[model samples]
Target: MADHEEDDLRMALRMSLQHSPPEAKRSKPRENAGVPTVSASPEESPEVKRRELMAAAAEKRMLMSKSVAASKPEKSADVAVAENSVLIVKDENRVLGGTVSEKPEAVCKEEEMKDVNFGEELPAADANQLFSMIFGNGVSRDILAQWSNQGIRFSSDPETAMGLVQHEGGPCGVLATLQAFVLKYLLFFPDELGKFTPNMPSQNLGSRRLSESECVTSGDFASLTEDGKASALVRSMVEILFLCGSKKRAVIATFSVLCQGAEEQSEDGQKDEIFAKTLEGLPIESASDLQKVLRVNTCTSQMSAFQQLKEMLPVFQSRLGAMLFLISALLSRGLEFVQADRDDPSPPLVTAPFGHASQEIVNLLLCGKAVPNVFDGRMDLGGGMFLKGIPTSVEVGFLTLLEYHNLCKVGQHLKCPKWPIWVVGSESHYTVLFAFDTSVQDENELEQWESQIRKSFDGQDQSGGGGFISVEGLHQVLRETGINLPPEKLDHLCSTGFIVWSEFWQILLELDKSLGGMKDSTGLMGKKQFDLFHFNGIAKSVLNGSQAISGVESPLQRPRLSILRVSVPPRWTPEEFMADIVVPPGPGGNDPSGKDTVVEVTKPEPSQHAPLVDCIRTRWPRSICNWVGDPPSIV
Candidate 1:
């Protein structure tokens, strides 16, 4: 059956080839030239046609045999096997040629060339998809669309468009682009942004030292030209993102070395192979030009660098320039040059999620060796340096910030940051919250009053003054200072009945302005009248969404109280109270004097027992006790 099918197939192929165009016939192999080709008429029967095809095929085989014999080579078995393989391939090609109408040789060569150059061309990618993938679920198409509506174009210019086309999309490219976008967004909406002085050295040549005047505010940034903005963006990425350094001197120094090397190569007319390879196609002319392009000093230099950075931005989009730029910047200065004074010794960041940014990244932005946790960042190392903490202000989510306030023991610095702005991060996105009025940050007068009040409480309290005072003690202090709370309101204010320093501070913060009229001799609100209403608005704004009370509540909620009362014999005198209940029995059980043998119990000083005493008085105000001299406080 197979042999019959093969014969039919061969006949069909021969018929088709015979009916082919004249060009195909001329293109056929030399072996077919001498064969007697028969033309079958349309009227011919199938049997006659088959017979003609079979005879023509036999003649073609005979001609092939004659050609092989005429050019037969004296070769080994291996060479013969190779020749046989080649002939088999050629026969297959020829058989396929009837329908294909072209030689396979040229096609095969073209396909091989395509495979070789496959990596040369950039992979196809949509700019939006690339960004979405790199930024993960944080940045979605909807968010990109929103940004687009706000005039943020992913592909703004021809260079950026082409760059996005060829962009090697990944976390690094996305991060760089995101940083650039953030800076641009700030520039676009300067009113929405707050001024902050990053803890980095000045980007100037004459004065490398950092000072308060070196602050780069939104106004300074907004005042820049388009070119200046671009230059600033690149400089920020290089110094903050790539190097992760707080020192601008390190970046400038590194670039200066590269410029010097390029200059030497230019002067000697014998380029260093390494230098030449590193800067192959870069159009750097002279050392001074390179300096102006890479470093920012005066306005002129910044504008010059802007032009160079604009061209380089595209290159950065299509390449992982973070590590490369880092290495180049640190070539002249060692890695230690960019190291933070105190940094996490863990391995560098391999991944950056929305809320869980790397410590280095946070440090670069916040200007401190910050811990990753959302804590107050305060540690008492037992010196005047107790005031030193991490970031004065931090960027955190709303819920995270709430937790920081309610659940965490937040420090003064974090509680009242220098700027009235926060970078709020959500589950899927990041946004900014800022105050239009900057006066909210100036709580110096209020803080000084708070400090004096805290000191006064500490002096009066006997618990070694660990920033806590009793509710009754605080009430007495407030009443003495001329601001009186109703008894029921006091209970509501302090649900625990024993107010800590924080609770006391909060109560003062929430006080009404009418009660803030009293004043002391010094004229400051600290010694007498605590005019906390001055910052009440500021406090409310800062703590807008951070309410301590959560969950369901009734219209008339009962105050929470924790109290323990120990019943004692009713008619006991003051000495009996101390002797019988307060003091434990002696090791010998009892003394033999028979007057219910008073046991001498060693006790902490009355001042040391003040906190316990205050707790007792606050909890059981109805209880009566007779005292000799100053009554012994509860301990």
Candidate 2:
């Protein structure tokens, strides 16, 4: 009963507390765990201040711990952090100081040693020396090795100067032609050759000493560095005199020397006799007016010298002039400068004149050989140089002298008048020009009048004036051929407003070369025509509606275009024809014919009387008899 009364009293107290006013609840304290929590006075503030102070103290302790950790390197992480700090400071210092760390002195020494290689040996010859100056010794050595194989004899002895080049007996005309060819090579050498500089004396007298003031040019060409110009002219004369455009001419020029049986021909008559006999069969049966010195029998020799030359080759490497002539007659590789008269543009069949060629032909053979080409700063050979195959003992000396003279003019940029005055040989007297000019002058004019004309502005106007085309026009044309160019460089070709049609055509042809790299292949026009012929043949076979039918050749294959215009039916359509035709099975995949399973057709009958269409539709397989579907036609 007493417990019940206490429970009742506790219930009554809870009810009274629950019914208490809002002012009493405001001062209530919360419980911690199961115990009632104590409260601070209002003036002293709540426990939040104490908690904030505690947190401040804890933060201070944490900061102290971090400071201690940063001060020491007890762990891997601490050492890493220290290193990072050092690096950051270093970077900042570098940025602020504007300087870089220097490489070790030893490293610089090693690099210097590698680049210079001062311990290596220098080149022995000027040719080799020039190569060394440009490239390393390795390339120089290789070029030297090649030069030795070229079979040219270079002698320092004064007595051997005349005999430096071998003379093969044949038509003196042949030698003249060979000489002209040699001059051609000489004129082109500066543009054709590379860093293979030959040996030359430092004292270049003929051309290198020319001055711009004398030529009325603006710049001081004399002051320019000699490396580019000097390298081109160095020792070029001997090479030009000794070599021909092709080795065949060189061999013919040197053939007698090649056949020389050790003893001198002048001392022993036996070798001369053989050489004369050999010359009996050469293309040159008689001597030209210029060849009187050669004494090749003009009256009685009947054998074909051209025939003999065709037979001589790797078997014999001498008298290149004779061999070249013979090869020209036999293989018909016609001259690069001269065109063949045959319908086929390719090389022609051998036709030996046997001393029957015309004077005009002979003139064409050696036309400009007497004159060195005057290149108008442009690398192209403007005037034709008559390069004869044969060269006289004195001619070699003459060319050598001219070589120096021309070099000085070019190196000094000596204008038109100061150009080379070359000496060219002829039947009677040698034609030596003190000043070489190309402008058309009245033949009857006096030398003084010609000299005055050369200096006048008229000569300047004559330089390059005519119908001209610019590089941009060519670039536009190249775009049509599917070549995309940005730099659009015209190699070895300069822009001119007055280029001749022939020269303009050459430029177009040259620019077309860049189109070779285009995605679509550059097929020949003949190849395209052939493809059209084949396609027409296949269409005719399809139109015939037979599996084993013979194909009709396209009118393009005919020599006459009138056949295409008159023979092919105007109503013919390839697509409709292909639709009507049915192809039959072919031989097994193992067969060598092709991968397609096409049926074999009978050989087409070539009939002259029959219509070309019927002739083309001679045979067809039976499988095409059922393909009756109609298709659209492009005709």
lDDT leader: 1
Best by TM-score: 1
Tell me the deviation in Å of residue 561 in model 1: 46
Native-to-model Cα distance after best TM-score fit, residue 475 in candidate 2, in Å: 41
Global lDDT of each model?
Answer: 0.33, 0.25
Please identify model 2 stretches exceeding 4 Å from their true place: 1-206, 209-337, 341-635
Give the alpha carbon lDDT tens digit for every residue of 62-118 in model 1.
Answer: 354446657985333222333210211122122222322222221112112221111
- Clash number for every model? 0, 56
Global lDDT for candidate 1? Answer: 0.33
Model 2, position 9: C-alpha lDDT score: 35
Per-residue CA lDDT of candidate 2, range 1-635, in tens?
Answer: 23322332332223222322112221212223122233444235544343333334334433544575579643432122221101111111111111112211111111122222111221134223222222222333332222212211111222111111222111323323333333222332333333443222222334432234323121112322223222222222222222222112211222211222212212224543444444344432212211211111111111222222222222122232333333232122123322322223232121122221222222223322222222212233347623222222211212112223333112112112222222222222121212111121112122232234223322333335533445554444444444433353444334454323345333333332344321111221101110001001001112322422455432311100011111121111122322222233354534465443433242121223312222122211011111113321111
Q: Which ten residues in a row have the lowest lDDT in candidate 2?
A: 529-538
